[model samples]
Target chain A: MSFNPFYILPELILTAGGILVLLAGLSTRKWEAPGKIKPYSPEALALLTLTGALASSLALLWRPEVVKGVSQFGDMIAVDPMAVFFKIVVLACSIFVVFLAADYFQGIRVHRGEFYALLIFATLAASFLSAATDLIMIYLSLEFLSITSYVLVGWLKQDPRSNEASVKYFLYGAVAAAVMVYGMSIFYGLAATTDIAAIHSKLVSYPPDGSPTHIIFLGLLMMMVGFGFKISMAPFHQWAPDTYEGAPTPVTAFLSVASKAAGFAVVLRVLVSVFTPGVVDWTPMIVALSGLTMTVGNLTALPQCNIKRMLAYSSIAQAGYLLLGVAALRLSPLALPAVMLYLFIYLFMNMGAFAVVTMVSARLNSDDIREYSGLAKRSPASAVAMAIFMLSLAGIPPAAGFVGKFYLFAAALQSGDKTLLYLAILAIANTVISVYYYMNVVRYMYFAKPKSDTPLKPSFAMNMVVGFAAAATIIMLISPEPFIQMAKHSAALLTGTP
Target chain B: MIPLEWYLGLSAALFCIGIFAVLSRRNAIGILMGIELMLNAANINLVALARYMHPHILTGQVFAIFIMTVAAAEAAVGLAIVISVYRNAEHINIDKITTMKW
Candidate 1:
């Protein structure tokens, strides 16, 4: 019940920063003036705001109370290692996205200030989402994130494709949200409390004979529809490919990495905290979902010619693999860490790949995979970086994706559950199927004939993002111990032991 | 005083109608209205449950308030995007908004 200001410093900074950036964008002064006494460029200001938030989040990681976990604001928010970990992930992705947007939107006439402000606001929502401990907080923050994303997705108002993408995303998002609220209402009626811990305690106290297991299960299933849509799980993933293909590249990157990561963070929290095994066993359902999501995502990804669309399916498949870790949570201690570790690796590789896409599409004005023919000849640095990202995404050796997938699969196998064992094997088979499409990008980069001999020079910011991501992908493979230990430490949730 | 089960039944019916409208409607605004209906149904459930089950605390009523505020915001953004789409594609029919497909 403590209302400590320190617990929410990062959110406060982001809220103030978003408003400041928006106001700064209203000024008519030359933002790009060299040697100016006071530089007020939206990009610089946005980066500074993100850096401030990132530093505070890092500082929160070392707080004495965080190790044991503490609830603030009447138990609405939980500041724990897991929440801090996801905050760092969201902020890191946002910082990289600012860099990508700076380069992508160069010389464009769009409202740059509003774009950065919305990004900061979206990050704010995600941060709140990861830490929310009440149904009301969760619903509010999740919808906040969705509303900001709908606006961000349609930022390029002149592009018909962007307009269509935003509309489709809004429709699906609104429906999913409404259904989720309905489910939350059911929980409210059952427990008469909005706090997750309270709900769990009340459910546990109910007698076995009189407990409303069927009603609880129904509510749980309905809520899953909302969470499933966020992570782009199968059967609820209809909007992702179309949105990814049509939205601006930087926004696409944010959706794939940051938004999905936030979704998983909240999902893990709710599944572990509120739905204990004594109440209901959710493992079987998650297991079935893991298998179906991967099979559908990988199989559909094979035929996509658009790189963004292909990557959309690839991310969906990655979500499936992440779900395998979730399905094994009760049986094995390794499950939570494995999921976190994979998401950390995914942030780098996915953002790096999208950075390259942003740069190439900015220059070539095309998203078609065929247009990337002989990129090795046109831009050797970018082509090589793209190849590394593609390799990492495919879970090939000497790349971080391999280490991540190995841990995820290992977690499932260590669970000793017959179903999880079969799921690991199915996941391995799906990985094999995934390689063809991942390598197809490589084939176009190096093996295919050149469209022209002119070299494509990526801007400094784009190059830095690509190089940094590529280097991290390879370096994590070489030394994964530190990252693994970090994940293990951050696996601690508010109420449960991992 | 009304019984709690009656209120639950009424809300359930409203929820089903909302879902049906969302699935079957072709107009974008029609779909948005369906979503609003669905949210309102949840609001009714929360308010009714609060009155019947937890009379001491205002948790459910407060929750209903928050949901109403968010639903309004959602409808605003949804309509803005719909208008943007209409300006670009010259129509707001969900079926005709398909410039992208796998």
Candidate 2:
């Protein structure tokens, strides 16, 4: 249980940054006038903090000793390439969200400091979630993330919709978390240890007949209910569309990408580490989940008129595709890398789409699809970027999403398992169904007549974020070699291979 | 001393009751109460398992303590959100807070 202070520099930076931002905000509250202090002042501080955290995380990538898998502080937090990869993703997503949020929150009249502080805290929790190896660490980090997110969803305190969204999210999140803890308790009872690897070793040492297989199965199932809720998988996905639509758009974007990434991280860690092959056959269950998730998500998205709700379903569908990798984990070597690569690509394209929606909604004050009519004529650059994002999300050629989907399908097919192959085909069909709705957004932007001919102008900061995302998606599509290599390296820690 | 199975059974029953309450209750605070019950069920399991199964190591007891702390934090946030909802909608029933439909 050797503690290394330097090992968790990024988390330290975020915690300190959050406290400082809180104090800064409270001190500023004494001013009499609302517009006396510009909102950008706090936003710049947030951006600075996020930039520092990202830099620290990136610095960790270059440290060879840290890159080699080692559990920090007595196996509670694992400092490995896999954790580093997800932390980088979380930090980068927060940075991008801050940029987009700086522009979004400029119009809102809330206490800006708390919002940024909570966002940073959520990021810290997410990083902890990806790295957590002990059950206590996992539960604490998850609750930390959830608590911050609940407040962020209702940050627009005056908006009734925000209030509704937060209440629903709080209720669902609390129940799911409680269910997950119950499962953890069962795990502890079975193994008499809270360390995940220790539990796995105990399970392995005790023969299947000797151990309580039924209780283990029940616990794992209950835990999946919580993870599934976080990732917005079907049957646990009822809260997503409403939450996405009602919460602030930047929060929606954060939830869609960073939060989902953390969910997948925890799921992968637990399933691969604790529930290894030959111990329990959970693949069939994952296969069923994948099939239902993609189909339900794609089909439900078809009738949605709100852009946020449609994207919410699209993200759920994306989660199904990611789960295909998890399902094929035992059969294919490419499974972990495929999931990792997809999340990286998902960060850019999905965030790009939501940022465009934010821009449009800001201009028209509507999230309705009809308001996007002739968006090309109104904002050509944004419309073009939106189309590219739509194409990428639909898994069309020459988009990064196509490459991500390609690897997942290839991984599933290469496994040569009958069920996995069938899942791959089902995913392909879902991809086609998804295109209709994604392209519908594009159609409204390109083909539909405008209700008003007023030209929309996005802020300079927004254009930069959108442009960067679109370009990254295209670049990754064109040359996925670097990202593929990185993904493979990051995933090697989990797969236990070079 | 009583067998561990009895304690486990009692906690399991409590957890089920909590789940039932969470699903059946229309009031927001009632659902929160259900969540607390479920959490306490886990806590009981943790402490009883530690006492019966692994007397030397207090990991389960420690876990129970952490769970209690976390449950307190969760209840605080849950109640705060409920109050905000009440202020906005003039009621805490889950049914009345449906501003955003699925």
Candidate number with greatest DockQ: 1
lDDT of 1 by residue, A58-135 (tens): 998888887778888889988989999999999999999998888777655688788999999999999998898899
Candidate 1 off by > 4 Å: A28-38, A493-498
RMSD list, candidates in order: 1.8, 1.8
**Clashes per candidate (backbone, < 3 Å):** 0, 0
- What lDDT does each candidate get? 0.90, 0.89
Per-residue lDDT tens digits of candidate 2, residues A1-498? 577777788899999988888877775552323332254466667777888888887888888887677778789999888898899899889988887776676556778778888999999999999999999999999999999999999888778998888988888999999999999999998899999999988887877578777788899998998888888888898888888998999999999999999999999999998888746779999999999999999999999999999999999999999999999988898999999999999999999999999988877889999899999999999999999999999999978999999999999999999999899999999999999999999999999999988899888888999999999999999999999999998887787831
Chain A TM-score values for every predicted structure, listed in order = 0.97, 0.97
Q: Which tens-of-lDDT digit does each residue in B21-99 have in candidate 2?
A: 9999999999999999999999999999999989999999999999999899989988988888888889998887777
CAPRI class assigned to model 1: high
Question: Which pairs clash in the backbone of model 1?
Answer: none
Question: Distance (Å) between predicted and true CA of B58, model 1?
Answer: 0.5
For residue A187, model 1's alpha carbon misses the true position, in angstroms, by 0.8
Which stretches of model 2 miss by more than 4 angstroms? Answer: A27-40
